[model samples]
Structure formats: C-alpha cells, structure tokens
Target: MHTTTPTVIITGASSGIGLAIAETFLAQGYNVVGNARNAARLEQTLAALNCGERFLAVAGDIAEPNTARQLVTHAVQRFGRIDVLVNNAGVFIAKPFIEYDQGDIAQLIATNLMGTVNASQAVAAQMIKQGSGRIVNVTASIALQPLQRVPSAIPILIKGGLNQLTRALALELAPHNIQVNAVAPGLIDTPMHTPETHEFLCGLQPAGRIGRPQEIADAVLHLSQAGFTSGAILPVDGGMSSGVW
Candidate 1:
C-alpha cells in the first residue's frame, strides 16, 4: 500500500457486482467505504473481505438523498477524501410493461435513477472542491439494447436514464477534473439469478455465457484509472448490445 492511499465509496456494496468491486479496490490497497441498506449485511461483508482498517462500511438506502450525504460525509471523515465513487446500487424487475404497477415504477425510479443522481450530486460536490475525482455508474445493457425475451421496459426506463445522465455529468464536470462514466453489463451470474436459469440467461449474451461479477468490477476499475475517458458508456455485456451476437 502507498503511504497516501486513495479512497473509494461504493454503493450496494454488500453483494454481487458491488461486493466484487469493493474487494477489487481493497486488494489494490485503496481505502474503501462500502454502503448498503442492511447494516448487518454490510458488517458480514466487511468481515468476509477482511480488509482491516482500510475498509469501512456505511449502511443506508442510497435512494434517499440524506443517505448519499451521509456516505460522503463518513468517507471523508474516515479517509480524509474520496477519490472514486461507484454508484452500483439499483433494482431490476422483469415483466410486461403493462404489468408494472405504480409501486414498481416508483421503486425503480427511487433505487436506480434517483439513487445515482443523489449519490453523484453529493460526491461531485466534494470532488469539485478537491479538483479531481472519478465516478463510475453501474447501468445495464438493456439500457442500450432491449431484449425481447426479458420484457423489462419499465426497469429499462430507469437504467436508460442513468446512461443519459452519465454523459451529461461527464461533460459538466470535465472542467473540474472529474470523470463521470458508466458500465452497462449484460446477464451477470449473481445470486439474483438461480442456477436453474443460468443456462437460459447465458444464451442472452453473445458471449454464450453469463458474466462474472469480477468482470464488471474490472471494468469499473479501468474507467476510474482511464484519465482521458469520460462520458463514455462502456458496455461489458458480452455483445448483448451488438445485433445477432
């Protein structure tokens, strides 16, 4: 570890892609602040990772603006400054557009779109004051390419919104030396999907298999270090965005 290690704040860090990203950064000797709604789950995550003093867990629902504020505040208080932020907290429910009720719409907006906006707003303010920062948002490939089999139009609305906001914020924050980007992943092999459905999901990606959480983690790490890259929506979806595999 360097004498002055940089710090990262990752949302939804208790499991799946978020958990992998947190582990990756911690392994690279960066101070990590992991946030999730379940405090006990966050504690278990911290214990499992065993990053010692370099990792801190902040538990909260990022859909709330106050949670975002508290995440930034706690990170700075513990690590002095936040160098990177990964807005990976989101929800997805696949169903026919007509089947999605108002509650589903509201939940998707809260967790996916507003969560990204709220967290980015808080982190950007701190980054602007520091004069440099990296923000990597976790979106879905469905944002760019719709899947006939998925029938997830309602959820796509929120993730697609994130893609647009990534470019907008990137341009707006470029002058301040902050890079804003997003990663659009395809069907990833997380706990969200059961093993019985893995083979079916695999066929959804052109790569002929589901992606690993570590793969998305690697993409986020790359964008963070890619100084000249901003506003770029890098799709790690194994050709899902490409027509006919």
Candidate 2:
C-alpha cells in the first residue's frame, strides 16, 4: 500500500454493484467510506471485508439532500479528503407507468435521480475546494435501449436523467480538474436480480452470460483513474448495448 491512499465515498454500499465497487477499491489499497440506509447491514458487509481501519460506514437515507451532504462531510472528517465519489445508490421499480401510484413514482425519482444529484453536488463542492476529484455515476443499460419486458417507465426515465447529468456535470467540473463519467451496466448477478430475470437478461446479451459485479467495478475503477476521460458513458454490459444479439 502507498503511504497515502486515495479516499472514496460510495453510496448504496450495503449491496450489489455499490458493495462490489467498495470492496474492489479497498483491495486496491484505497480508504473507503461506504454509505447506506441500513446501519446493521452496512456494518455486517464491512466486517466481512476485514478491512480493519481502512473503511468506515455512514448510515443514512442518501435520497435526502441534507443526509447526502452529511455523508460527504463524514468522509472528509475521517479521511481529510475525498478523491472519488461513486453515485451508485438507486432504486428500481418495474411496474407499468400507468400502474405506478404518484407516491411510488416520487419515491423512484427521489432515490434514483435526486439521490445522485444531491450526493454529487455535496461532494463536488469539496472536490472543487481541493482542486481535483473524480465522480462515477452508475447507470443501467435499459436506459439506452428500452425493453418491453422490463417495465419501460422508471429505469428509462431515471437512468436517462442520470446520463444527462453526467455529461452536464463533466462539462461544468472540467475547469476544476474533476473528471465526471458514467458506467452503464447490464444484468449483473447481484442480489437485486431474480434468477429468472438474470437468465432472461443473459440470453439477450451476445456474450451469453450475465455480467458480474466486479466487471462493473473494473469499469468504475478505470473511469476513476482516466483523468482524460470525461462526459463518457462506458457500457460494461457484455455487449448488450451493441444489440449484437
């Protein structure tokens, strides 16, 4: 490990792609701050890594603007600086648009879109003060190509908004030397996916396999270090974006 390790703050680190990315960064010798709504689950997940003093868990609802700011503040207080921000906290609702209640739609937008916005804003301000940082937003492949089987409402709207935000923020933050980019992952074998859904998504990909969480984490790591790469959306979806099937 280097004498000085880069510090990263990952939202939704309790499970799925967020948890995998946190583990990967820790393995690479980075000081990691894992943020999630469930304190017990966050503690359990962090304990499993055996990362010792290199990791911290901040428990709160990131969908709230104030909590998002507090999450960044906690990381800064612990690590002195945040070198990377992974806006990976999101909620997915698969019901048809018409079937969605107003509250359900609001919740989906709050967790998926507003969460990213709030976290990015809070962390980017600190990064600007430090004069450099990286922001990686995780989006879904369904945002690129809408699928009928997968209810086209939430993911399509929320992830598309995220992609747009990625580009806009990249341009705005470029002058500060803060790189902003997004990763679009498809059908990763995470707890979020059911066995039947995973198999169906795998069959749609030309690679004939569902992606692993680590695969998406690798892409996140790449974006984190690729200072020259900004406003780009790299798809780690086993060629699902190419429609190679």
Candidate 3:
C-alpha cells in the first residue's frame, strides 16, 4: 500500500511542535487537518503554509470528547480518510503538587491524557476501517524521570499518564495494523517555556542547548513513514534522556 499521500490530523497545530509537525507533513505532500482551540491563530498558520488544497484548519478543543470525533469527521469529510494522527495538544504548568486545585488537575488530565485518548480512539477507528494507519504522540521527558520538579503537579501527572496510555494503546492497536508510538521531547524553544526557563533546561541537558520544534517534528515524520515500527518511544531530547544534570 502506498501511504505516501496520506491524510494527517494534528492536534495543537497552532504553534510549537504541533505546528512544525503539520508543516512537515504538508511539505511532504500529505493532506493535513490541523486542530486547535484558537481559530485566529490556526487560520493564520495555515494561510502561511500556502498548502493550497492540501490543508484544512479545524478549530476545536481536543480535550472535549465530542471535539475529537468532530475533528476526525471533518477531516474525513474534507479529505477521504485519515492515515496519521498526531496527539500533540497538551499543556504544562509548573507548581507543587500540593498547590494544585481540583480544576487545575482536571484540566491537565483532560487536555493531556483524555484529549489523547479521545483523539486516538476516534482516529484509530478510522484506521481500522481502512486496514492501516499510524499514531504519533508527543510526550515530555519529565514522564521518564519524575525527579525534575516543575512547579506544578499537573504536568507530571498528565505526562506520566500519557506515557502509560501510549504503551497500552500501542499494544491494543497493533493487532489492527495501526502502529502507535510516542516521542518524548526534552525542553524545546516553544511559547510554553520562557527564555529563562529554556536556558535553565538547556543547561540541564548534555547538549547544552534546548531542542527545536522542528527536531521533534522530524522524528514524528520518520515514525509515520516507518511501517514496521510500533509501541516505540523515540526521544528527541538532545540527549536529555541520558541524564543531563
């Protein structure tokens, strides 16, 4: 099967790593549907891509269960089918676990963990119908080593759960011929992290630098093309996973 001209759905596609991944797939001549909460930003980003008829921008909160189904529905309606799904919509807040309120905890889980589940479930259904597909999840290095204290307990909880979800779904989906994988990214220069925070994180890495969104996007692209790979966690962390302190 020639999956080269596949249709991809990427959540959190307004900026950062998600945006980069969308752009990468667009560049590869794949039809792409970008989902984000910010309609204005999504429009601007897609307009800049100049993808002509190869792209569609859908505005919705992936954290909501219905929104994931809507996103997949619109993508399939616009294009024909969905071949790749990138669960990239997530948030990170720094705070002590004790300082977190119920709402904060709920939001983190909804956006990071539940959002991934919803999107993956919806997309996986389509993939199974089609007989083959790929899913690439974006996770954080904090999930690997829980020692790094981000001020917030939410990010840790959400990311940790996300990692577990990734592994579980990979196993369940493999039998359906749908490969599921995740990329554990170290600190990257995105709007989520401030300059000071980036510098601090960079110093903690063996590379002495923070990673780029494009770097992570590159890994996503590779995973999408690797047919025989599944249930894999590829870390594009500038060696941050190698213990950088």
- All candidates: TM-score: 0.97, 0.95, 0.94
Instruction: Specify the highest-lDDT model's number.
Output: 1
How are the candidates ranked when ordered by TM-score, highest leading?
A: 1, 2, 3
Task: Give a tens-digit lDDT track for model 1, residues 1-245.
Answer: 32368999999999999999999999888999899999999999999998788988989889999999999998888888989999999888999988999999899998898889999999999999999999999999988999888999987888888899999999999999999999999999888999999989987878889999999999999999997999999999899998655
* Native-to-model Cα distance after best TM-score fit, residue 98 in candidate 3, in Å: 1.2
- Candidate 3 global CA lDDT score: 0.85
Off by over 4 Å in 1: 1-3
Clashes of 3: 5
* lDDT string, candidate 2, 98-136, tens digits: 898888888888888888989999999999999999999
| Model 1, total clashes | 0
Better of 1 and 2 by lDDT: 1
For candidate 2, report its TM-score: 0.95
The parts of candidate 3 lying over 4 Å away from their true place are 1-4, 149-152
Clashing pairs in 1: none
